[model samples]
Target: MLSAAATPAQLSAQAASGEAGLERSERAAEEQQADNIIVTGRAQKLYRVETTASTKLPTEPLLSSQNVSVITSELIQDQGARDAQDIYRNISGVSFFSYAGVTARGFRQEEIFFDGLRGDPYAGFSVPQLFNLDRVEFLKGPSGMLYGPGAPGGLFNYVTKKPQDKPFSADVRGIVGNADRIGGSAEVNSSLGGGFAARGGLFYEDRGLFRFNAASRTLIADGGVSWSPGPVTVILQATRYDQELDASRLRGVPTDDDGNFLADRRWNHNEPGDFLNLRSDVLQARIEAEPLPGLTLDATMRYNDATEVQNYHEPRGLFDSDGDGIRDATIREFRDQRRDEESWSFGGNAVYAFDLGGDVGNRVLAGFDHFNGEEIFAGRSLRGRNRVVAGLPSPLSLLDPVYGQSDPATYNQGPFSIFNTDSRRTGFYLLNELTVGPVIITGGIRQDNFHDDSDGIVFEDEATTYRGGIVYRVTDEISLFGHYATSFEPQDPSVQNPLAGGPFAPTAGDIFEGGIKTALMGGRIQSSLSAYQIRRRNILQVDPRGDVGNDGVDDFVAFGEVTSKGIEFDLAADITPDWVLTVAYAHNDTKITGDNGGGGILNRVGDRFANAPKHQLGIWTRYQIPDIGIAAAFGGDYVSEQVSLSGQPVRPFMIFDTSLIYEVGPIRAMLRVDNLFDKTYAVSGFIDRTGHFPGEPRSIFLEVGYAF
Candidate 1:
C-alpha cells in the first residue's frame, strides 16, 4: 500500500517515525532541514519503501547494506489482512511457529517493538490486530547493535498511525465472512486548529472457530494528538486492547510423522467453561526538536499495564487402558493462572549532519535508552498429578467424549506458585554514516547492561555488539552491498542441575551478508537479491547422556550450535499506472552443526530446524480498470515441505487468494476469497506427542466502507 507521492502532512508523519532521511539527494536534505518536510513529488515506485527507522541511521534502505521489508497500510487494507498472521505470507523467509510466534531465517522470532522502540504491544499469546497502524517494518538478521538482546533471526516493528494536518476525514466499515464472522470499525482524523491535530480509531470482532466450544473476541481502541507549534513537535497517544479465547491454547491434532491425523480435524478436549483472556493499556509520548539546521533531536516514552487470566483443561496424553492397541481416552488436568505486569521505557537520540569538505557527506547519531518491567504470577504448581481431577469425564474420552461432567476435586487447587519477576536494561549506542561519491559506509556499536530478578534469584550481564556495512552504487539504478553484524542474549540463570551442569552461558549470533539492489524503469521497478550466512552458538539442547540428575526428568545442556544460509529475492513493479505487482522468494538451508550427543548414526546434527522451510515464494498483483472504479487482485503463497519437532513431514502447500474491489469517490466495497482452492495442509508441526497444526479452509469475506 505504498504511494508515489504524498502531501506535507505525510512528510511530517514520516519524520515523527524516524523514517525521514536523505533518500534522494543533498538538496532534499537541505529542504527537509529548512521546513522539516521533504517533497518527493517526482515519480517513484508505488509499492516500494525507500527507508526504514530500524537502523536508527538517517540512510535509505537501498544504501544501508541491510535487508528490510516494509508492509504499508495501503497494502494491508487492499489485501484484507487483519493481523500479522495474515500478512506473514507476503514477507520473505517468514512462517508461523506457534501462538504469535514466527519462524524467521531458520529461527523462532517473537520479538516485537512499537515505533522502532522495544515495547510489548499485546503481551502473551494474542497477536495485535492491524487497526490504527501506519505500517509494519521487518529487519532481517541480528539487530543487537541497535536494539539490544534478541533472537538471531530478526524482529518486527509496528509503526502507529499519527495525527496529520488535513481536512476533516472520517471512515466507517463493516465486515461479514464465513465461520460466523462479523466485525466493524471506524476512524476519524481532523485538524483541530492551533497547530494541533487528532486521530482516533476503534475495532471489534467476534468470530467462531473450527474447534468445538472454542470462539474468539477482540476489541481495540486508540487515540492520539499531535502538535507542531513552531520548530518543535509533540505527540501523545493511548491504546487499550482486550481479547479472549474460549479455550486453552491448542497444541495440535494427534497425527503421525506423515501428517495424517488420527482423530477428527476439529477434535478438541477443552471444556465448555474454560477460557483465556488478556487486557492491556498503554500510554505513549514522543517529542522532536530542530533547534538548529542540520541537527535534530527526538525522545520517546511509554508506560504499559497488562493482565492475563486463564483457566482451562489440558490433555495429558492418549490412554489405552483397555490394552486393545487403541488410544480411546486422554488424562485431563485442570490449570488456573493469573498474571499482572507493568512496564515502562524511555529513549532519546540526537543526529547531526555535516560536510567533510569535497563531495563527502557524513551523519553521526548518538542514542540512550532504558527499560524496566515487573510481573507477578500465581498459578497452579502441579501440571498433571495433583492437578488432575478424579471423576467421570476428567479423563476425557477421545472417541466419544462427554461434556458437562462436574468434578468436585478441581474446585479447590492444591499447591500454587506466587512468582514475582523484575527485569531492567539500559543501553548506549552510536552510529556513523559516510557518503562519498557512489560509496556509502555505515558502522554502529551499542553497550547494554541488563539485570533480572526472579523470586530472589538474580542474573546480571553486560554486552557490547557491533555492526558494519558498505554499499557501492554501481550506477544510478544499480547497487551492491555487504554487511556484518553480531548479537548476544544472556541466559536466565538457574540452579545447576545435578547432572546437566551449572548455569548456562550467554548465546551468541553473527552473520555475513551481501546483496545487489536495482531500481529500473524510471523508478517504477525496485528489486533486491541477497545471500547470507548466520550462525548461532551455545544454544540449549536436551542432554543425550540419559537422566544423570536422577530427578526423574530429562536434562538439558548448553552445547548446541546451528548455521543458516540462504538466498532471498524481492521485487516490486508498477507495470502501468493502474497495475502493480510484488513478488518475494527465499531459499534457506539451516543445519545443526553442533549439539549434545547429536546423532552418532542417526542424530540432530545436520537436521533442518523445525518449521523452517527450504523454499518460500509469495506473489501478489492488482489491476484496476480504467474509469470504471473496479480493481482485481490475485495472489498466491508457496512454501516447501518442512519438518516438525517430532520429525514429521509437513507437506508443502500453495494457497491462492483473490479479491475484487469497486471504489467510487466516497463508497467502496471489496470481496476477498482466501484459500481459493480449499487445500488441506498443515500450518506447522508442534510436538512429538501432539498433532500438527491445521491450516484454515476456504473463506470468503465481504466488506463495505464509506468515506466522509
Candidate 2:
C-alpha cells in the first residue's frame, strides 16, 4: 500500500538523500570496472513518455497518475528475453498462473497490448518474439478509460521498433544453447523510395527441457512501411507468429501419502503424449496529422486472427502401485481442443494544447478518443476413458481396470462439437489537463458499450467510467500525487445453450487507487509507491454437483464479490557511473469480500481466492564499462506461498537469472543463464494437487551479433 509521508518538504529531503547515495554508487562502480562490468545483453534505458496507460490525452501519457513500468529494448537484449512470457517474468507484480496462458495480478487477469492495440492473454494463441520490439511498458491499474473493456489488475503495452531516419541498417544474430537449441534473428530498417520508410524482421528459435524428447519451436515475422507527405504520415504493419511443441506432460514423482516424494527423477508410470500448437497473425494501419498548431491527431486500425490446438493426455494409471514394485496399470485419456478467433479495432485521438487568458495560468492538453473491437472463440473437450473394474486392494485401493487406450467413439472424442462465442466492445473518452505553477491536475471520463454474441446469443450493456487526479511538485526532484479511477469488464456468461449446452454472461468490477512518484539524480533514479483496492461482482464459478459432462444445474450461476487490496513499490537508479539497479515489491490481500460459492469448494475455504500470492519481490542489477565495452546483470524473483482449494498452502519457490555481454565496435557477444541455481520449483500449475510439476532447469545460451 502507498505509505503516508510526513510532508511534501520531508519527501523532497528523503529523495535528496536517496539521490546522493545513488550517484556515489555509480562512481564506485566505474572505478571497479573489472568487478562491475559483466557483459550482459540487456537494454539499459527506455522511452518513458509514449508507453503509459492514458489514451485520452497524449500529453498526460507520461504521468497519467497510474503506476507505469518501462522495459527498453536495451533491457530486452541485455536480459535476452525470448518471448512475451519472458518479458512478463522480468516485470514485477505479474505472474503466469497456469499453462492455460493466463497471467495473474492480485488474483485477477492481466491485460495485454501490442503497439497500443488490444491483445488477449487468455486466447492461448501466440507468444510474440521480442526481436522486433522497441520497448514494453506496464500500466498498473484498471484501464477501462483507454481500453474498450479490460481487466482491473493492469495492462502491458508492447511498442514496436519502427524504422528510423537512417538510410539503411541491418542486423543478424544467433544463439546456441543446450538441447540442440540454436536460434537466430534478422532485422532490416531502411528509407524506401521518396517519402517512405520500411522495417522488417524474422526470428526462429527452438529449445528443449530436461524432460525426455520435450522441445518447442517458435517462428515470428514482422514488417511495416510508412508514407509521409506534408503534415500527414500513414503507416501499415503486419506480424505473424507460430509456436509448435512436440510433447509435454505434467511432471510427477513417487509419493507415499503425507505429500513426501522423490526429486528430478520422474516415476516410470505416466505416458508421454501431450502437445500444443499455436499460430497468429496481426495487421495494423496508422494515420497521424498535425491539423493545427500545438495539436496532433492520430487514427489507428488493426486486425488480428489466431488459432490454437492442443492434445492433452493424463495417464489414468499415473497412480500405479504394483505388487512387484512396478508401474503396471496403463490407463490413458486425451483431450483435443481448437480455438479460432478474429478481431479488429479502430480508434482515433486528438491532442490540443491551449492557454488560459491572463494570470489565471496556462491550461494544456484537451483530448478525445474512441475505439471498438470484436472477437470470437470456440472450442470443446472430451473426457471419460478408463473403465472401473473391481480388483485387489492395497494400502491404496486398486479396483479400476486401467489400460493404455480408450474408445474414441464411446467417449465422444472425435472431431468436435462446434460452439462459436464472440465478445465485442466500443468506447468514447474525453480528458483535460491543467498545469499552473508547480501543480498539475487531470480529469477524464469514458463511456463504454459492450456486446457479447455467442453462437447467435447476444448480451448488450454499457457503463460510464471516470477518473481524476492531481500532482503537486514538492521540489524539483519530488512530486506528491493521488488519483481515483473506475473501470469495468463484461463478465463471461455461464448459461449453457439450450441445445448445445455451453456456458455464456458478464462479470464487472470497480477499482480505486492512489500513488506517489519521484525522480531524482538528474532523472537517473526513479521510484514509486501505490495502493489499490478492487471490488468485483458477478464472479463466475462451476457447480459442485452439476454434471461435469453436461450442463444440468443452475448452481454454476451465482453472485459474489472479491476485493484485492495491495501495495506496490518500484525503484530504478544509476547506483554508480557504471551500475544500474531495478527493484520491485508487491503485497496483496485478495479474498472473497462477500461469499456465494454456488456449492463449489471455493466457498468452503472461507472465501479465499486461489493462486493469489501474498508477497512478491524482484531485483535486477547491471554494470556497464564503456572503457572495456563490457556489461553484466543479475537478478531473481521470489513469491510467497499460495493457498489451494482445500485451504492447503503450496510451498513457495524462487528463481534466479544472470547474464554477461561484451561489445567490440559493431560486434557483440553475450551469454545468459536462467535458473542458475537449478532450483527445483513450480512456476505455474494446478491447485489442490500435491505433485506440482518442476519448472525449467538450469539453461545456458551463447549469442553473437553485429549491427550497422
Candidate 3:
C-alpha cells in the first residue's frame, strides 16, 4: 500500500471539490492524503483508470467510444443506488419508462457483464440485488463490436467487486419505509490461502407500493473468489436471485377520461392482472494472464437459466364480437402462464502494448475479441373449467378477490398457447488504439453472424461494422474528441412472408458524435458536454392489436427512416470536503424523417418511439460530518412526457429521495426515504384505460451495519 504523502496538486483538487466549506475541504484533503490511492480516482498499475462517466474521460480512454458511463462502487454506495434501474434513471438521455416491468430495458433486455466476462442475458433481468459489484459500465451505443447483439439503446456491464487484501471487513444494514416495506443487506470480505481471497454479499427486500394493488419480495446472494499464481490470475463468481410480485391492473375498460386508465372489470374484479413469480441462477469464470511484460490475455465464459410463472384471467366476452355474457360466449376467468429461458456466452481477447522507437513519445496498443450467445424462450397458457355470470352468486370472485373469479370454463378446459420463440447469435471483432504525444486515435472492425432458428424455421445472415475516434488534449484542463459508429439490428422472428414466403430482412443505423471533456478545480470538479446525431433505416414497426398478425401469421416489413439529434451534459464535483454533488441533463429531438405509415407500411413511423423521453434530468448530493459521525444524501430525477407505442402521450413525472447515516465505533446506521415527495408517477402503464402501472410511492428504510 502507498503512504499518505499527497502532492500539492492533489491537495488543491480536493480543496476545490469541497468548495462548499473551507474547513471541511481542507480536512477532507488531509484524510485523502492519508489514504493514498483511495481519492485519486485512479486505479493502481494493476489496471488502467477509467472515468466512470462519459462526461469525464481519464487519460487512457476506451477507443472509438461515442459515450460511456461508469458507475463506480464508491458512487453507488454514497448515493445508495439500489439497482440497475436506479443507475439508468439517474443518468441523462435515459428514463425508467416502466423499468418496473420484467420486459423493460434495465430489467430484461439490457446487455450486461460481470468482471470482464460475458453473462447470460436471460438471467440479467432477474438480478434484483447488486451485491459484490465493483462498477457498472454503460457503453452508450451498439456494442456489437465487443459484446454481441442487443438493443440499439446501449449496453451495461457489471464489474463484480473483488476481494481486497486488507484482512477482513463486514457491513450490515436494515431499511424500512413506505407500503410496509423492510429490507437489509450484508457483505463480507476475507482472505483464504496462498494468493487467494474471497468475498460474499447477500440482500433481501420486501415492499408494497402505491398502486391499485402491488407488492414485491426479493432475495439475492452473490460470491466470488480470486486466485493469483505466478503471472496469471483467475476469478470465479456465482449469484442466485428469487422474486415474487403481485402485479395488479385493469386490462380492458382500460381507459379513463383524458385517455387515462381507470380499471379493467373484464375478469369480474376491479383489478385483474396476475402474479409474477421468478427464480434465476447464474455462474461465470474468467482468466487473465501476462505472457510477456507488455502483453496480456483475457478469456471468459458464463451461463444463466431462469423460470417464470404468471397467473391471470382472460375474459372472452370482452373481445369476442358475438358478445354473449353466458356459457355460449363465455371465456375462462383464470389463466396460468409459464416461461423458461436459458442463455450462454463465451469470449476471449488479447491486448499488446509497445513503445514507438523515438522521441515522438508514441505507443501502439492492439487487441482482438470473439463472442457467441444462445437463447431459448418458451411460454404456455392454461385456462380453468368453470364459469360465473356478472350477477351470479359464486365464491370464486370472493375467494380470490384480485382475479374475482377462478372457476374453470366448461369448453376451453386444458390450455391454449399464445406465443413462443428461440434465438442464437455469434459475434467477433478486432480493435486497435494508437497514442502519440497528447493525441490518441482508435479504430475497430466487427462482424456479427446472427441466426434465428425458431421451431423448425431458420433465419440467418451476417453484417460487418466499423468505428473510429480521435481525442486531443488541448491542455491539462481540457480535452476534445469526435467519434463515429454504426449498428445493425436484424428483423424479429415475428416477421411474416408478405410475398414469396420469406421473412423480412434486417435493418441498420449509424451514429455520429462530438464532445468536450474538462477537469477543473484540480480534478476535483469534472464536466462534459456532447452532441450526437443518429439515423436509422429499414426500421420495423408492429401492427395494431399489439401483434403482427399476417392473417393469423405474424407480419413485418421494413419501414422508412428515423433521425434523432441530441445534446447531453454531465457534471460532478466535491462541493466541500464533506459534500459531493452530481448533475446530468439531456435534450433530444427524435422524428420519422421518412416513412410509409400512410400506406400502413409502418405502425411506429411518425409516432414517437415508446419510452423515449424528450428531456431527462437528475441530481444527487452527499455530505459527511466525520467528527459527528453523521452523513446525509439527497437525490432525485425528473422526466418529460413520453410517447407510447400507439402515438399516445404518457404523462411526465418526477421523484425525490433522501437518506441519513450515523456511525458509532464499528457500527453504522442508516435511514432512507424513497419517493420523498410522494410524487404520483407511473413508471410504466397505458393511458385512456390502457391499464396504468403506478410507480413506487413514498417509502422509508432503516438499516444497521458493522465494518470490521
Candidate 4:
C-alpha cells in the first residue's frame, strides 16, 4: 500500500526517478540493445487530452476558453452507464427535467446532435444506445456560433464509432440484472483489404421497471464502411433503432398537501394495455480530402426517418368528491396518438492553416449547412372518465387499488386532433484562431435563416450571432481564458400574441464566462474552475386579459426575461499508478428577472425556474490491484431540492453506486450496483399537481464478455 500522506508532486517525482533509473540501467548494458525493451503502463483518469466538439478544431482542453466535459468509453464501461443521464452525474449543473428532457444552466435543453448533425427533439424518448458510440461530449454555454439556433444552456454530441484499420477483432457481451432485465451486444471490426475497412455492432435489451406493468424492449444495429484509396477518404454508415414500452412511463406517485409522498413508490396508475412504440432509420455519408499540404476539406450528409405510436390510459389526479379534504377517488384519462417524422441535413467545411512570422500560427474554417424536417401528428383523448369497472364506483379508491381491471376500449373517444409542422433552416459560419507567443485568440460568426409552417400558418425569421474568446497561457501547464457569446432559439409555431398581431419572435440569449485550467503531475491530472452568467430575453408570457383557460390564438405575449448564473469546479487525476479520482461540483442560481403584466402564475419576476436545482456534486474513485487483475470503484451523486413550476417543493436526495471488475487475457467480468441505499425520491414532476416521477430502487447487474 502507498502512503496516504504523499503529495501529488512527491508521487510524480518518484515515478520520474523510477523511469530515470530504468533508462540508466538500459544504457549501461553492453550486450543488449536499450531500445529493444519497452514498458507499457495504464491509468484510470477519465479526462481526455484533446477534443474538437467545442471549437470544431483539435485543441487541448487546457487551452480552450469554454467549459467542456468529455465522457470516455472506459469510464462509461466502468460505471455501467446505460443512458446519457447516467453519464451526466460526473458533469455539474446538468440535470433531468424528464426522461426525454434535460436542463442545463437553469434552461431546458431539447436539442441533441449526432456527429455534429441535428436530431429530432423527441429522439430523447428512445434513449440512445451507447454500444456503437465512441464518446459523449458536452459543450457548455451559448453555442449558436457553431450549431446555429439552439438553447443557450448547452448541447450534447454523440460521436459514433468509425471503422479502423486493424486486424479482425470481435467482442460479445451479456448482462442480467434485477427487475427481470436482460441484455446482450456484439461488435466486430476488421480490414477488408485494398484500402477498405468495415465495422458493425448490434445491441438488444429487455428492461423491466420498478413500477408495476411498466417495461421496455430495445434493439439497435449500426454498420459503417470506410475506403481510403488515395489522399481522399470516404465513409458510409447506416443504423436502425426500435423501442417498445408498455406505457408512456410518465405517471408518478402523488404527494399530499404537506409535500409528502402518499403512495407506495412501486405503485403505477397506468393501464396495463397502454403502449408506446418508436422506430427510426438513419443513413449517412462523409468524405474528407487534403488537396494541399495545409488545406483540408470535409463534407457530410445524413437522412433520418422515425415513427412513434402510443396508446395510454393515465391517472390525472386524486379528487375529493364530497368537498372534504381527504381524497377518496382517482380520475383517469385516455390518449391514442401517432406521429411520423423525417429529417435531412447536409453540411461541409474547409480549413486552411498558415504561419505568420516567428511563433505565430493561424487557422480558419468556413462552413455552410442546411436542414429540413417535418412531423405529422394525429391524436384523440377522453378526459374525466371513470375506471373500467362499472357500477362499483365512479372513480377507483385511492387507498385500495386493483390493477388490470380497466378496459381502454370502453372509453368514449373525443374529437380527433391532427396537425402537421414543417421546418427548414440554413446557416453559414466562419471561425478563425490565431496563436501568438503564449496567447490564443478565437472568433466566430454565424447567420441563420429559419422558416416554419404549421397548419397553414407560416413564420419566418433570421438572426446573426457571434463569439469571441482569448486564452492566455501562464505556463506550459496552466492557462486562463474568457469568452463572450450570443445565441437564439425560435419560439414554437403555435405560440402567438394579439398585442404583436403576429407570431412570437425568437428568444435571444447572451453569456459571459471566465475560467482557469491546469494540467499537473506530468499530464496525470487535469482540472478546471469556471464561472458564468447567462440571460435570455423575449420569453413568452400569458396574457392577463385573455381567456386564461381557453386555447385562443392570442393568449400569450412575448415579453419576459430570465437570468442564470453559476460556478463550477471539476477535476480528474491519477493520484498514483493504482489510484484514480474524479470530482465535480456546481452552484447555480436562476430567476425570472423581467415579466410583463401578463405574467402567469409561475412566471413571477423573482421566482426560480422549475426543476432547476441550486447545487449539485459528484465524486468517483477507483483502486486497482494489478497482481490479481481486479479493480473496484465507488461513486455518489448529490442534488439539492427542486421545485415545480407552481413552486411545489420536491425534496433533495443522494444516491451511491459501486462496481467491481476482473480482467484476464481475453475475458472480462463486471458487477455493478446502483442506488445502493434504496433511497426513495422524485426524479421529476408535473405542475398540474398530478404526481412526481419516482427514482429507481436498488438494483444489481452482472456482465461477462469475451474478445477474440
Model 2 has how many clashing residue pairs?
29
* Top TM-score prediction, candidate number: 4
For all the candidates, what are their Cα RMSDs to the real structure? 5.9, 6.7, 7.2, 5.4
* Top lDDT model: 1
* lDDT for each residue of candidate 4 in 479-524, tens digit (9 for 90 to 100): 8889999999888786643333457788899899998877665556
Any idea what lDDT model 4 has? 0.74
What TM-score against the true fold does each predicted structure earn? 0.89, 0.82, 0.81, 0.91
How does model 3 score by TM-score? Answer: 0.81
Q: What is the lDDT of residue 265 in candidate 3?
A: 26
Off by over 4 Å in 3: 1-29, 32-65, 100-109, 113-127, 247-274, 314-334, 358-403, 407-413, 416-422, 496-501, 541-556, 599-605, 685-689
lDDT of 3: 0.57
TM-score: model 2 vs. ground truth: 0.82
Residue 707 lDDT, candidate 3, scale 0-100:
67
- By summed lDDT, the worst window of 10 consecutive residues in model 2 runs over 1-10
What is each predicted model's overall lDDT from 0 to 1? Answer: 0.76, 0.61, 0.57, 0.74
By TM-score, highest first, what's the ranking? 4, 1, 2, 3
Among residues 3 or more apart in sequence or in different chains, the pairs in candidate 1 whose N, CA or C atoms overlap within 3 Å are 1-74, 1-75, 253-691, 599-603
Q: Write the per-residue lDDT of candidate 2 for residues 170-281, one digit (tens) a residue.
A: 9899989988899899999998877899999999998875654457888888899998888889989888878777654343333322223333433322224456677888
- Candidate 3 residue-wise lDDT, 3-102, digit = tens: 1011111111111223544554464466653312234222111011233322112223322235665665655555566776656654566655443222
Clash list (residue pairs), candidate 4: none
lDDT of 1 by residue, 61-171 (tens): 667687777777766877888887887776787888877788999888887888867668577677778997888877889989888888888888888988887889999
